[model samples]
Target: MEPPRRKASFLASMKAVFWSFFGVRKRRDYEDDAVNLNPVQVIVAALLGVAILIGVLLFLVKMAVSQ
Candidate 1:
């Protein structure tokens, strides 16, 4: 009988994804994430992070242009 996989929490997954976006992570952390993180949660987190980054950049550009 196979044991069920223990999924990491959403917050943990998001934190992992955030660090990934910043291009920084320890090898030990990456190994742990590979075992615990859910693929769907990671994808969602990555998308949300990208969207927020883009939104912030756009807002800053607009503010600069308006001045």
Candidate 2:
């Protein structure tokens, strides 16, 4: 009999999110993440990532317009 698998940690989920944002994940890594990552964590991470991206873009645009 096999032992039960451990749940992925929040930090692991964040690492997965970062790799996804860059759009360059390996197939093996993707497969591993798919099995380990929690849906709720992924959703939260994605929302946070999008918000950060928007904030950065806004900051850059504001700086460009000011100059």
State the lDDT of candidate 1 residue by residue for 1-67, as single tens digits: 8765857999998899889988999999999999898889999999999999999999999999999
In order, the Cα lDDT scores of the candidates are 0.92, 0.88
- Across 1-67, the per-residue lDDT of candidate 2 in tens digits comes to 8754649988888888888888989999999888888888988888888899999999999999999
Clashes of each: 0, 0
Evaluate model 1: give its TM-score. Answer: 0.90
TM-scores for all candidates: the values are 0.90, 0.84
